[model samples]
Structure formats: structure tokens, C-alpha cells
Target: MKTLLVFEYRRGKLTEANLELFSFAAALGAQTAGVLIGAETLLPAYPGKLYLGDIVKCKDYNPEVHADIIMQAAQKEDPDYIVFIHSSYGWDLAPRVAARLKAAQVSEITGVSEGKFETGCCNGKMRRLVRPATTKAVLTIQEGAFCFTGEAEGTPAVEKLEPSADGAGLEFAGYEEPEKREVDLAKAEVIVSAGRGIGKKENVPAIAELAKSLKGELGASRPVVDAGWVDHNRQVGATGQIVSPKLYVACGISGAIQHLTGMRNSEFIVAVNKDKEAPISEVADVMVIADVMPFVAALTEKLKQ
Candidate 1:
């Protein structure tokens, strides 16, 4: 099988998610090639062939033009699968390329089982494994689902192509920066996340205290955020931020698959929950079965002392 990875470059660098794409491609046991519509300097030491479209000519993001560049690369590579990182960019561009190529399109793919792609369904409460009925397919992988650890064997062979930028109805405008977030959970070395098991919003501070004692940031599961116990920016789950802290303490979290997918890559995990069979226990390095408030209070006191 041959897989083509569509790399996204932003802020003068390749997005970190591209590493996960390499890891995904490696799992497929296929010949892999990459394409980027950006500066050559932004290219990584990919192990496979790389197709570069100069950013100067292509300019800023225009969905139609970028899709055409990817199409040109696809024509050259003739890959069975064209893969993207499931981000805002992929959400917009993947379908367009798929439509042009007349290929199957799958989004938010979390895993591969027996040569089939695994994705969430029914609002992430269940998983469904799917195989494309078409000869070619477009895929967008869920962020943080795959970890890249392997090193590139050698420099990739570079092929330069000039794709047309004309005929796009959309005009290019200067990029606008998103509003600064109060907290960037992705950079936290340690994260203490609260779940619905905390009982009530009033008890949220106790969890925050535990996180403070650990010198870490406070994170929340989707339910806690939805219930207005925590801000949306602090949420840690499939619908929230994907984090891989050095240490993660999941409090009252029952380990829903959506929640686990976000923090399962933590170097070490400790889950405090009353239920021994909570799904979080499967990925946790230490599972503490105790009342949420008491356990958090005790741990905070111990850490402070």
C-alpha cells in the first residue's frame, strides 16, 4: 500500500500533529510520501519522498488552490490513501480533495484494527471500525492518538512542483491570531483533571487545590465543563485539548474513551475514583479507589506537608 501524508505548516513550522501522521503511516506498513505547500525550509527529514510547493507562489491558505496542489502531488504519487491530521485545516481541505479524487473520506480516525480504520460514533460513546468501499480513500487522524518515536533513516528525496493559484473565488487576507487562552493545558508538565464524580461545582476548588499543590494546572472532563464547573479551555478530552503531561492525575473520572483518548499518552497516570472498574483504571499507572473529596484533600495535604 502507498500512503500520502498531507502536511500542514503554520507559524513557519510543521504542526506537531505531523509526527503522529508519520507514526500512523508506519503502522500501515506501506510506502509513504509527504506533500507540503510551503517553504522548503519547513520540510522535515522525512524517510520517504516529499513533494514541495513553494509557499511564495501558493501564498496563504486558499482551499481551492491548496487542494489543487495536493491533487498534483496525488497524481504523481498515486497513493491508495491520502492522510491528514484531523484539525481545522484538515476538516476543511480533506473533503474537497476527496471529492475531486472521488475517493472515500474518513475523519477523526483514532486507530487501525485488522486493516480497518477505527473512529468514534454515536457522539463518542461507541467505536466503529470501517473500511473504504472505494479503491482510494482520504483520512484524517485524531490528534494524539498515535505517538511518533522513530527517527528518520535518511533525508527524503525532494520533488518540487508549481501548482496554479488562480481561479480561487476566495481572496487571501492576513491571518488573524486567535484570542490568547488563559491557560495552555498542552504545556503543563502535570495535570489534575476533575470529572463528574467530584459530586458538585462547589467541590471543584478542592480539585483545583490538589492541582495547585502538585504545581500543575487544573483540567476537567467534558461533563464537568458542560456542567459549568470548569471553563471550556480547561477541558481535557476528545472534544477538548489533547494533553500528554509528564504526570496526569484523573480525579473522579470514569475513563470514558473520549476522555482517555486525550490523556492516555501521559508519561504516568494516577486515577482517583470510587469505582474500581472505572475505564480510566485501564490506562492509569495508579488507581486509587476512594471518595473524591477526601482523596483529593488528603493528597493535597500530603503534598503540601
Candidate 2:
């Protein structure tokens, strides 16, 4: 089946979610085409057909303008399937594309096997499976739910495409850059996450010190994020970024339903809490019963020495 994979670029290069879409598209045994709007020079080399719509300009992103461009491309490719990532951008554009094409949108897909798409249920009950109703389908893949593979069997043929005259009329008015943060989650090898048990706003720096000692990223639960102790992007939960670092240390987090949805997939989970009966202990590879602040501080100082 022929497939068109749409990805949003920042300053010309493909974003993380785009690379993820390629991985999923490759798995479906569909011929791949990448639809992008930017200078072709910014994109890293890829094995696929490439199309550029210079008119779809945005310093960052504008939903309506983006949707219009994608719809135009969908008409041009008329592929059996169109794929998007369930990211900030995908959330805005996927439904619009589906509406214009009159296609079934199978979105929030967490797992994809040979013939079925798997999605998460609220309480880890059973994963909902959706089979394609027709040969033509539109899907938005859930980011962080799947790992990426660099090896695809064959190199795709690349081609240049020009947008239609209607596409040329749209304009990118303005954009504001997203708030910058100190860490990049995708590249973090080790992560240290804290829960409400840290007790007070001032104590977060202790966990930060541990992360610093280990040269890792600091992540938090929803409460910590809501408390304004850290950036929202640092949250490790269903509503936040999903990370799969080499070693994940959970401090004071009780492993609540919402929190586990994010970091449950970590390679190694270590929980530190005074109560051995804490829910997080069940999933932790190592359980430490202690006050989070003291333990984190001692650990950080020890590591430094």
C-alpha cells in the first residue's frame, strides 16, 4: 500500500515525532513518502519520496494553515493510508485531515502488530484493538509508546513535489518559540523522578542534585508539575512525556494510576519511600525505605565523593 507520512519541521529539520512515524510506516509494509514544508536542505537524508510546500510556512505551527496544506497533499498522494504522530501538532492536524478526506481516523495508536492496532485502556485492563474498516485509513501514532528502529530493508526513492496554487495563497503570520528547558528527554540516558512524597517545594533541588551527580535528567509526577516546581514538559505521566531511559530512579512517588502510565516502561525502576507497602515498590527493581530528601541528599553527596 502507498502511504504518505506527514511531519512538522522546526527550522528545517524533522522533529522527533517524524522519525517515529517513519519507523511505524516502515513496519506497515507501505511505500513511504514524506510530506514536509521547509528548505529541503534542513532535512536529514531519508529513504522515501519527499514533497515540499514552501507556501505552508510557519515559524513554528499554525493549525488551520497546516491542516489545509496536509489536505491538499492527501489529495495529491491519494495513498491507501496517511499517518501522523499524536503530538502537539498531530492533535491539532490529524482530525482535520481525516475530515477532509472522509476517512476513518484510527488515532492514539500505542502498539501496531502485523494486522491490528493496539491502544491503552485507562486502568491497564485490556488494550483496545481496531481493525481497518477499509483499505484507506488515517492514523495518528501515539508517541513514546513505541521504540524506533533505524534499520529498514530497502531505501525509498525520493521525489520532489510542488503544492497546488491554492496552497500558495496561505500565509504564516507569526510564531512564538516554545519555552526552552535545560534538558532534552529523548537524549537522556538516566532519569530521576520524584513523587509527592518529596513533601515540599524546596526539596526538589535535592532530587535535582542527584540527577546532576549522575548526569541525568530530572522528571516529576503530575502533582509536582501542577505545584509549579518543574516545567510541564518534565512530567512523566500519561499526560506528559514518555521516556525509556537506561535507569529510572523514583523518589517519593507512590506510583499512582496517572503516574505509572508514563514511566512504567522504564528499563529499570528504583523506588525510594518510607513505606515499603507503597504501590511503587511493587514495580521497583530496588526499594529503599527512607525520607526522600535525606536519601537523595546523601546519595548525591556520596556519589560526588
Residue 222, model 2: lDDT of 90
Model 1 off-target regions past 4 Å? 122-125, 165-190, 196-200, 212-217, 221-228, 231-247, 253-267, 272-282, 288-305
- Clash count, one per candidate: 1, 0
Task: Give TM per candidate.
Answer: 0.76, 0.66
Candidate 1 residue lDDT tens string, 277-304: 7778779999999998998998899998
Query: How many clashes does the backbone of model 2 have?
Result: 0
What are the per-residue Cα lDDT tens digits for candidate 2 across 1-305? 78888877755456766777777877787777777766645663576666665634433355555666666667777887888877666767788777777878887787877767887554333468888776677888877555576753444354555433333455555666757756567568889987789998888888988988999999999998999987787888766777778888998998764577577777888899987777676578899999888889889989999
Query: What CA root-mean-square deviation does each model show from the true structure?
Result: 4.0, 5.9
Model 1 residue 55 lDDT score? 69
Alpha-carbon shift of residue 295 in model 2 (angstroms): 10
